[model samples]
Target: MAVTIEILIIILLIILNGLFSMAEFALVSARRIRLQQMLDRGEKGADIALSLSEDPNTFLSTIQIGITLVGILAGAFGGAAIAKELEGTFTVIPEIAPYAGIISLFVVVLIITYFTLVFGEIIPKRIGLVYPEQIAVKAAGSIVIISRIFGPINKMASLTTDAVLWLFNSHAPQDPVVTEEDITSLLEEGTQAGVFNEAEQELVQSAFKFGDREVTTLMAPRPDVVFLDLEDSFEENKEKILTSGHTRYPVCRGGLDSVIGVVSVRDLWSQMTAGEKPDLTLLIQEALVIPEHITALRLLELFRTATTPLAVIMDEYGSVAGIITLHDLLEAIVGDLSTVDEPDEEPGIIEREDGSWFIDGMLPAEELRLLLELEILPGENEGVYRTAAGFVMSELGKIPIPGDHFVLNGIRFEVADMDKRRIDKIIVSKIRHRGDENPDEKTDNHTTS
Candidate 1:
């Protein structure tokens, strides 16, 4: 009965060690935001868990004390009492009696260590990771009690740790900082867990990156911007109005380089409806002027503070670069929004049946990076370029002929079509592995746009 009591005491010690291990891992691994949320919801013990986590020195000292004391007591008591009992059993055999003391002590230590390693460490740590927040909260009160019981010892240990750090001129440990990547990771988790849909996730991500995008990337390029030329005949202006089917037009005096203001079809119609002539100059509204290099986010702020949403983008040389509207900025965040009475526009990217992709030269580099699963595009940091055409040009460092092709990170990019000096369209084959068949070379059969 006395031997049975000793064995039970060893078992109890192992269990206590396991609790210490569990509490340590749970508190360390639990997300502070999650613990705070639990506290906000009035969950018991969450506050203590959060508090303990904030003071790593105290919490670690408390957990180490429990684990160390349990280990020592279990080892000493278990090795002595169990080995003595086992030695008696072995001595019954005459041949084993001589080495029984040594053999029994070894066997007793081995059994105790195995149980301690599994029950007191690995298994508990795994369980703690599986439900860190809950386990941390549940274990917090007991840990606090233990910490208070041995407060002086833990305080001494922490003081010693601080003195050693002071010798090195180091600062105390700081709380982990939450960054944009952390929020993005949580958003991805929320997406997988069905709390957010893919589109919703993309919108949030786009909004986060909106401040980094340049105005030139979002504007309608000079060649694409239709205008109401004041010098043109009435029939010519009417043809521009009918053919473009757009709501707003920049009223230029001479050419695209010289812009006066913006005229809206709605403002023209309102004049005609009021029994007045649809005078172009009379209908022209003052448009906001912004530098082409401005970020889309700052432009948004400008729009918010301005009377009109239409803005004329000017390049460094004081030439008209492009035009932008509030709708364009909205599209950058939420994706393309087709205007009423217009057919659905073709997407910037289309994958062919042959596994090659037809990519528009005007496609944004950010979109290209995601499509290619690339870590980054060239000139991403310094804002050297914006579109895929700009990316291709920066890579080649010269004008590219229609047949020009190159490989990057195992993906083949070929200039499929060109419009004079500009890149009009590109054909991109999917990524190839090192050992896969060599990417087939293509002859340029496409026309010059």
Candidate 2:
């Protein structure tokens, strides 16, 4: 019966103001990494605080209503108390008491507004943001109570917000993509926090670069590829198997060009115990095939989908260019192939006592680039070439003879070794002086056939 309209209005304002603060806290609560960290450390309320933040509208509405109610109560109590204190001093005319009441009311309201804005809204919001995960988890228990108290109001706010967004033709993405850069950043952070070593970080970064690499970059060149001749006697195949040190070999009748199927060591051993000549046809498993032009990333996907372990890489003419295995692809992503024998193509940077570089002839262009940190290797052309020798022959536009030391760019190349068709070994050294003229700069100075 004693309740005044002023008291009611103050109560409503306090509740609304509180609701505004709560909304802000809820919206940003979950994103607070600090709060999440606290929650992870077994903080009782921290987890709840983060959960409340996940649906900010509900938490915010509830808090806003509660704070608004409290703010109004503070204003009302102050105004009434002040009016009572001033009653005799300012009430010479009874009508003057109403104006005094109005002044007291405005002063109390302003004070309450200042404190509420500074402490209740701004301070809490700032602290919550600074320690979101921790704050959310700690506030989780309280947020639940607030949610229950203002359930209807929370629902209304959420519905209204959703409707407004829908009207604007805006919607949140489902299953947002985690970008390569995001993963890299996370890995970098992990590295800084000692979760990963330098080598591991480099490997991860290289794995991401797999998309730009082709199958040939990691393939065992055709010369180094081990295969079982279909025409060879069972004993001969067994001898090849024992000496070759391979778990799997292509079953080729003529050469790599006629590779029909892949023969596994398991199948070979199984037949050897049976006391019968192992039939090449019966022993071979279907070969997983791919083209040389296929990107290593796509090849990895193909390996996953097919559930096959090996793929024979061929050129456009259908000739087998090289062999790639699941182990090769894994090595591309992780490290060295564990089971596959290192191809006979050992391109070592032999630091001889004479101070001359004795680089292996069978060295791959990629290996050369990696070791020398040079960018001389050409990209994939429509030809079946993978090694430095293949690259040199490609550049020369003819078969490279044994006694040739061609200088290109600032790097000098001496033919150390050569086979019938390709250059197997080459020795390269960085020249101190600019060669006669810049190869790229001279209009007609580019090396010709």
Candidate 3:
């Protein structure tokens, strides 16, 4: 009967140790955000879980003390009581009687250790991990009460631990959390594992890259931008507006540099339908001016708050560099919109039959780099110049004429066509050589024909 009581006590101590271990693991692993959400939904005990999570050190210390005390008591009382009980059982054999006490003690210790390791530690920890929120909430109140009862001892232990850590120039281990890179890597792995489709993966990756893109990278270049000259007559402006088919046009007094405001074609259409001539001054709306170096993500916010669809990008000298629309800003996130109606219109890159590429000069350098599969372009000043034309001009240090060609980094760039002084089209072809490709290789070959 005494042996039975001792075994029951030992089992109870093991259960108590398991409870403390479960509480410690569950509370530490529970997500605070998840707890808050549960609280918002009026889930019972979520608030208690949150309270315990907030002051983790004290509650964790309480659990540690409980586990330690339970373990020590179980070891001492279990071994002694079981040994006393087994000593009587071992008296049946006279030969075994000599070593029976030691053998009984060993057997008792083994049984206690096995139960403590499996039931007290592994099973409880596994349960806590699998159902952290549920277990954490259940264990929170009990742990908090225990912590309060041993508040002084917990404080002393914490202070002593801190002092010892400070003396050794060490700190407590922080909770392991996922980082941005880890999330990105997980997203990539998910894509490979069929968890995320291609379009979904692209959207997520685009979102991550959205903030890194500057306004200049997405804006229509100055050469491609269609604007109205304030000095022009109503008929001239009306003709340009009809031919261009653009809804919004920048009103520049003198040239592209002297942009005053933006004018909407809707306002012009209203005036024309009202029997009044389309007036540039009256149709113009306030233009939202943003620095060229601003990010596309920030531009989206500015557009949202300003309630403007059109914004003029200005350089450091306050000159109009280019223009960006709401559609342009969104393209950074969703990628290029399909132009199904305009099939004849040339894309940024046109592949030829001879494995060469005819690229638009205004195509973004980053896009061109991807198409060409080149690590670095000739002259890619990340902020200053973002387009292919700008990159070419930067490399040559002058406006390139038609038929001017140069080779750099195993790729050959030839001016296919030029619109006045501006580069309009370029021919990109890969140069395959046995040895190192010469960067100074220049040719007057216009490869378009």
Candidate with best TM-score: 1
Model 3, 187: alpha-carbon shift in Å?
Answer: 7.6
lDDT of 1: 0.85
- TM-score, prediction 3: 0.70
Which window of ten consecutive residues has the lowest lDDT sum in model 2?
440-449
Q: Write the per-residue lDDT of candidate 1 for residues 1-449, one digit (tens) a residue.
A: 66788888988998898888988999999999999999999999999999988888888999999888997788578658778888988888899889999989899889988988898889999999999999999999988898899999999999999999899999865645687889899999999999999999999998988878888888888888888899998689989888888888889888987888888888888888999966898877888999988999999999988766789999889998999899889988998898883447678999999888899998888888889898887687678888898888777677898878676666778888898888989888865655532344332222222
Q: Which stretches of candidate 1 lie over 4 Å from their true place?
A: 42-45, 86-111, 141-176, 341-343, 407-410, 430-449
Candidate 2 positional error at 148, Å: 30
Better of 1 and 3 by lDDT: 1
Clashes of 2: 33
Which segments of candidate 3 are over 4 A away from where they belong? 80-107, 168-213, 231-245, 266-282, 305-308, 339-449
lDDT accuracy of residue 155 in candidate 1: 95
Q: In model 1, which residue pairs have backbone atoms overlapping below 3 Å?
A: none
lDDT of 3 by residue, 185-247 (tens): 878999999999989988988887787788888888777788899888877887887777777
Query: Rank by lDDT, descending?
Result: 1, 3, 2
